[model samples]
Target: MKKLALAAGVAVSLVLGVQPGSALAAPTSVVLAASQASWDQKLAVAVKFGLGDDFALVELPDRDFVIGIWDHVKDDPEHVEVRVAAETAFAAAPEDTDQLSYEFIITEVYAAFDRDVERERQEAEAKRQSDLARSAAAASIDVVADAALLNGSDADFVRLIWERVADDAKWPKVKAAARAARDGADSDRTAFIAAGMAAAARQDIDDRIAADEAKTEAEKALERARASKKLAANRIGMPVTDELLNLPDRDFIIRVWNFTPDGSEVQAAAIAATRSLDPVVWKAYIDTGLHAAVERDIQIALERKYQADRALAQQIKATATKNKDLNLVYWTDKALAGTPTQLDDFLRAGQYDLDLSTSFGAGEVLPSWSNTVAWTGGIVNVKPICCTLTGPELGVRNEPGHTGSTSLMYSGLDNNTTKSYAYLKSMALSRITVKSSTRLSYWIYPQSNTVRPEVKPANSTCVAIDLLFSDGKNLRDSLLKDTKGNRAHPAFQCNKVTVGKWNEIVVPLGALAGKKVTTLVVGYDQPGNTGGYRGLIDDIKIAD
Candidate 1:
């Protein structure tokens, strides 16, 4: 019978031109009037008229009707819990007409309203806590900013203020303002400290409230900013302040200290400056002290070099004396007597280039016929039969020479008379041919102890070079001119001879053109006040 009643209800809905069981479908005037009545009135009419199963088809109400009720109460504070519960239930059976019945909806809404109410209370409390945290942070920043305003030049104090709100994510405006103030001009910094910070902080708070951001996230953001700022500052060697504007000065001093030699004056000055831990001291050192110390250090190095060069010069002088290198010995003596620069030059290059040597051989002078002879009066005599007087002995000694290891040395007693003469000569094996362009060149070193003092300075007539030709002619009477315009016999008169230095003599044989040179002689005459006489001769060359 119930099945029959349900079929009958559906049939009646269909005949009325309405979708069966569709409450949204337009209904007849009787059904519309019935739907317009209250839920209680509709129920009473159905029971009184014995509507039976056809009551279901009467289009009592659907999801749209429940949705309307929900909308009305959803925002009502007094019924917030109930509205939330109804919303949950309605949403579950929005399309199921059986589950969306008024009785089921009302029962579910009232039953779970208390749980929703408790949840709402907890959420409100959490929001309150978060608000308090953000407010507290902002208040702390305000206090610091107020303190910073009092001393603008106090970098530490200003830094403290910046640190508090430098990169607060919950306060982006505040962070930006702080950065601008920290890095900007004095006026910008002053403005931020005076009022800009507070305004920016307030803006941040409003932004946070609007976004409903949690306080825990704000704390984490603050920590991240602090870590990032510290890392960046450390990596870049920290930002400069008003007092420490010259950063390069500090770096330069540090490099000097590190790179200079350990016990040096420059290094010492750099160490003292750096260790003082005063920027003023560093600046002073860079400006004045460092340069002064460096100059002193250079002088010290020069002194050390002088000492070393002097020692080396002494060693070279000794070697030159042993080798009879008069040129080397002369330069070494000069270097020792002069400045360190001269000594350094001699040691470095002068010793090798200045020392003279000869290519002439010992075979050119017949050793067996080489002898020394002295004459009482200033007479040119080559024969041994002359006034009997002890002449200086001729020997090869390695004491001083212009060009060779050994020179023909004349040493022994001499008559203390101005007219006395002593000479050493080497007779050639054969008469050597000569051309008009041929010249005789030789170096003479006169010992200071042997030569007369009067002849040692301007001109020395005592020293002479005599050549004997196979034509029975000699240079003493010949009109042959030396490199200087003086005759060959009086060579020392033409050239000034220093006692301790080598003197050169050159005689052009153009006067004896085509003459054959048989003998060569270097002699000292007029031993004015001598007890003994000594001299050296070297580099005997008979070339054109």
Candidate 2:
């Protein structure tokens, strides 16, 4: 079914970010007080503050309500901090007529409020340490003493030592001789003394630098850890207690919540997203805070999912709509369509309808009976059941219209005793007087391994359909490629049977010759193949 749609890209944007002044940006206290108001009112507030997409409900395993905001602002850490602070504060505030009362603030709220503040404090500590390192480097050198050392020292070390001596005016040195001794001592002791000073100073400075680096690094690591933790915590899992991702399984995802004592809002959101996701199994990523201030935000996320699914469905629908010749959407539970198979009905999400519906042999009992439809794509598969033998009739063969050749292989073909008797039945070859534009179509799907007498392959046996027709004498058989019989048409090809969904078979009327008198047959045929290799058949149509 097609839906009246909004641009999918726009809907996705809304889920990713909440605009300024949107409801998501509102002080938690304000939202708590006004939650009783209509959804439109809250949405207006969200848009006003540009926080519509930033907020969502955080469900506790024990079923408690908590609000979560995407407070990761790269350039505006302050704003992020402020929002967290407001949400924390509002949690503690008592509801007033239009806002939360100041006196209602509590210890728990204060603890949450301090979270952002602590982050800032950690960041500030990092900045302070960086500044300290720069200051230490700048203060270590003396310019004037350095200049004197250049002229006085015999070596570069001499200059450095002399500068130290010059700084010590109380040193006992007499005029030129004192300068000479100092200069001489400058070279001799310079290396040893300078090495000692550097070693000593660097010990303390290195420690400070290391501490600062560690603090900054630790803060960054913490931020990353926090984000990873939040992502894990916020994930929406399939509502089913078992593994929902398992392929080829029919399941359902249901989301039940409390929204407006009546739970209507929760129901609406679930219906919308479910229709959009249209998953094989019923899996629900539910926000339990249906009555909370964040319900609207949850709805936004669901709406986004819906729009995405709608866009994809619309594309598939367009293929059908544009091709008016496709008057039907053949539906079936079989993973892949086989020849000689029948098509059932389809479920529409919004618009368009299915003309036929079908169920395969066995295991059809698990289907859902809700007003909604069940279509599992990923999890369901077709498993092949091997040959088995039972007592009785031993072997009996029924062949359709081959005259003597039909009964020739009677003894060669086995019923596999344990399995039901197998036979081929083609539509009676009746001649039509005139060439009419006719469409021959059918739907087919794969069956499960639990089902008996499916294709075993090892015995060169698998279920297949063969369609043969002739306009006068010009004869065309089931797509030669898909037919399991002779290799008359090499170019004709179809996928080898595996676990998958059903597909449709359509032959345009133009493919047939204009001459009258013809024959048509739909049935399974085994050339050299034997044993119980049979395919299921249902709904067959020939329409003009």
Candidate 3:
């Protein structure tokens, strides 16, 4: 049967003479009319029935308290409890019955009871929300940690509880249990926490067994992650433990183990990684690396050959005809065809009559900014700005050439925001003979882009090479370029030029027909702020 509300149930029980049962259960109301009486109406009924004071004792405008009282006191129709309450009110009045008012007392009591009921309801709701939050926090402990707690490895479980359940009512019990597991050896820790779990679950040792099992699984996973991390470092070629540069080979990298191997998981993984690579792949890698070493040796050999051929170059330059001098021609051809697969292709490219350069060739010329050689043109300043020159000689060893040419490192820059130019020229070399078939060529190695504002600047914003030639009468800028193609010059920059490596720049004499030339100038010009622009010059040649 559906029960009526507290006040209504109490009122109906009173009006219909139904005896109240226990504190928890009230009988179903067959009469809905009395059960639905208003609060003021119920107060009036309680006053008229001479139970107004007893009603106030309920501390709420509800019938549960009344039902409880009925169980304790109600035995007759002329209820002694109500009579005693009324007599007590009268006796305490100190006035006659006419002055006594149970109605006013019941009204105040009913209002106070309503407030108390609301307060109690609010308190109960707050408690419920608090419990929900705490429960959620406890359940939110990491699954890994939870399993750890159930098993014997309770470190994660202890830390999780400390973080989430610090303020919980049940925290102390679990905290002590987790602390025991965390602080003790595996067996002792599990035994203590399991004992606590046994009490909370109010069961036997099976709960403890489950906890121990869960802990074992969580710990196993932790160990595996640790091992994998250490192994990953080895796979990527870092130190598996102490030494990185030299590590043991594949066979020594890992050892198979049947058990947990307690303190050696990472060691085992390192060994396994090395073993995995022991077959044909590692040998292939070693073979591939040998190519660079072989290439370096080849460069050394070529430089020696070049040094031996300098006297030969002078002899050939003085006498070789357009198609003769096979030795000089053969070697020159080889020098130009870079890194060819066959020696024939290598020996057929740099066909030249002159290799008028240096591997800084057998001399220690001092670095002089002033050009003292009368045949070699002096450094000229094109801008109104003053610039400083560093080395145009042999002894300054700052930058190195290909096979150590004792390179020319020239930088002519200042702190000026205006333009400046400092360049090396070959104005006096008119008598060094080249036949009608002659062209000038040399290798330019870049530490920076040779092109100006378009390419990235290394130090100087402008770098260029110019050849001054006489159209039989006046010397003019015959070829003006900075290693990039310029149609205006029409002599140099005949093809695409790349920087950061040696580039063979070849200029045919036919391009300068009816012209006599003496000067080859390399110039640096710029608005100067980043100073010290440097380039490497090597194996300069005038060949047929």
Write model 3 residue lDDT over 416-464, tens digit each, in one string: 4454334443222222234556656656565554433322335432444
What candidate 2 gets wrong by more than 4 Å, as runs, is: 1-423, 429-437, 453-500, 515-519, 526-531
**Most accurate candidate by TM-score:** 1
What lDDT tens digits, residue by residue, belong to model 2 across residues 446-489?
33334344434322223332222211121222222223332221
* After superposition, candidate 3 runs with Cα above 4 Å error: 1-359, 363-399, 414-418, 433-436, 448-461, 469-476, 479-484, 487-499, 527-530
> Each candidate: what lDDT?
0.49, 0.28, 0.36
Measured by lDDT, the strongest candidate is 1
Cα displacement (angstroms), candidate 3, residue 3, comes to 99
**How far is 274's C-alpha from truth in model 3 (Å)?**
99
Worst 10 residues of 1 by lDDT: 374-383
Please provide TM-scores, in order, for all candidate models, with all chains considered together: 0.29, 0.20, 0.26
TM-score of 2: 0.20
Query: What lDDT, from 0 to 1, does candidate 3 have?
Result: 0.36
